[model samples]
Target: MSDDVTQDAVLIFAKRLGEIIATCEVSAVWIDSREPCAWQYIRRDGETIIVTCKTLQYWAVRDAAARNGYRLDVKPDEMDVMPGQQITRGIPHADKLSTLAVTPYLSGNSETIFRSAWGDGSEYPTLRRMLRYASTADDLGRAGVIGKTAQEMYGGPLNSSSKVQRARDTGAKEWRALSASLDTARDELIYRSTRPQKDD
Candidate 1:
């Protein structure tokens, strides 16, 4: 799909997702496409979830956090980006936290709810069902749903193999370098623009 189509899809998805998770305290939803072929959803709780249809394997949630100046505690290889799957990580609004207890819980719980409501299927139907489920579920039922999702995602082999880990490490290094270069270029542009100009 074209960029416009992809962005439109993401926006629509965000709207539906926001509605479904409204009770979960999702205050706002916005998309950032800093990485090509991938869209990152920035949440009000300082968590980020990234989605992409690209074939390349990326640590989507981590990269999104890194791009936004928040470093999550997860290893680079933990979560691989795949279509219809969201990688989520909680980040502090100001700086990295000394401990990761609450952030990970919030991030993991939110991710679980989303995956449960919208299992690997077409978007609209899944979301419609999810909304129905959320609308009727009490707090205890919602917690139960999240618990089931947590068990499923974390129960088995979420870990990458050695080879995959190596590749992820290399990709992370390259991504960091590129990000630093872009930051430098942006800083230079701002400096030049703000400097007092002399007569040519």
Candidate 2:
């Protein structure tokens, strides 16, 4: 799933996610449930941006920067690359979002990407798979991490509840431990994407 397939799946996923969030927000209004949300939380460095979000939210931003493209490096599981930073160098595009909940470099690295579900880059199972594909058995041993997959960590993929709980825990812990590092983010706002609807 590394080539066009992975890319296409991710594109469809982000596009669909944007739509779902918008729809859920809209539906909320029908019952007077809650006000619509138009922003996301993000952290970044010079040419890198890290978003600690549910899985959907992370893919919402990436390197490609086309309206729906993200060229991710998918770094090694043991590179100490920090959990969530794929080094995306720009802001996101969202028709709905007015602002992004921005902090500074919370993880030791300036660019980190995190998923509320997996707690760290342990969310990146692909990195491990790629290693298995490219490396000799000895190389894997040298690499040290077989693959700290989210499934391995939590017994299975996360659900909405798990994601919420992890995000709360990670956000609090990181904020407490790394508060001093939260420097002035560049003045910017980001993302709420919507694919154009077809004229049925």
Candidate 3:
């Protein structure tokens, strides 16, 4: 989707979310039948700021800073950017969160964006998805080469729990072998880089 469309969706989503929260009130007194629920609001930075009735936390600090439109640094798939960051007061305005930076793709260069969006997952799959909208075939190919090289260097299938378990049981010998393979792959990519290759 276009950036405009995605942004519009986010705006609509934010408004709807705000409306939903406006109707809900938390009271621990009714915990016997209805447990006190924690409400989380997704700020423009894609950070979910949660309000816990037990602590009577209203996200005053984060909300106050965000109300003035501060740039938020958030991790991917995280509820809060700075977890355990405390808020001592109540936020006066809620709509200000709509202006915070949310989309990861909107900031940084291609490489930086790619790396940030990938998180700790398999780099190849992430690269493949990012390459879908690449401006040129060469760009996609280069990313593929990078992905393949990274995958091989990582000993492949890091996400496969079973494989990792098997590798772990092989102990010190396997670690040495895998480490050697990775070093070789790193050297190969580095050697190619020093020769001055096309960016694409």
Predicted model with the maximum lDDT: 1
Stretches of candidate 3 off by over 4 Å are 26-37, 40-167, 170-200
lDDT of 3: 0.41
Candidate 2 segments whose C-alpha is farther than 4 A from its true place: 24-57, 60-200
1-200 per-residue lDDT for model 1 (tens digits): 23443454455555545444443333223234232332344456877554333211223333444454444565334343455433444444332232222333334345444444434534333223334445666774534333233233344333335433543454455456545655565445445645899999
TM-score of each: 0.22, 0.18, 0.17
- Screening candidate 3 with a backbone cut-off below 3 angstroms (N, C-alpha, C), the clashing residue pairs are none
lDDT tens string, model 2, 92-153? 44322222222321222234322322244243344433344446555654442323222233
Q: After superposition, how far is residue 61 of candidate 2 from its true place, in Å?
A: 9.9
| Shift in Å, residue 49, candidate 1 | 30
Off by over 4 Å in 1: 1-160
Model 2 lDDT, residue 1, Cα: 20
Writing each residue's lDDT as its tens digit, candidate 3 over 103-167 gives 11122233444344444434334334333434344665444433333334356643355544443
Query: Whole-model Cα lDDT per candidate?
Result: 0.41, 0.38, 0.41
> How does candidate 3 fare on TM-score?
0.17
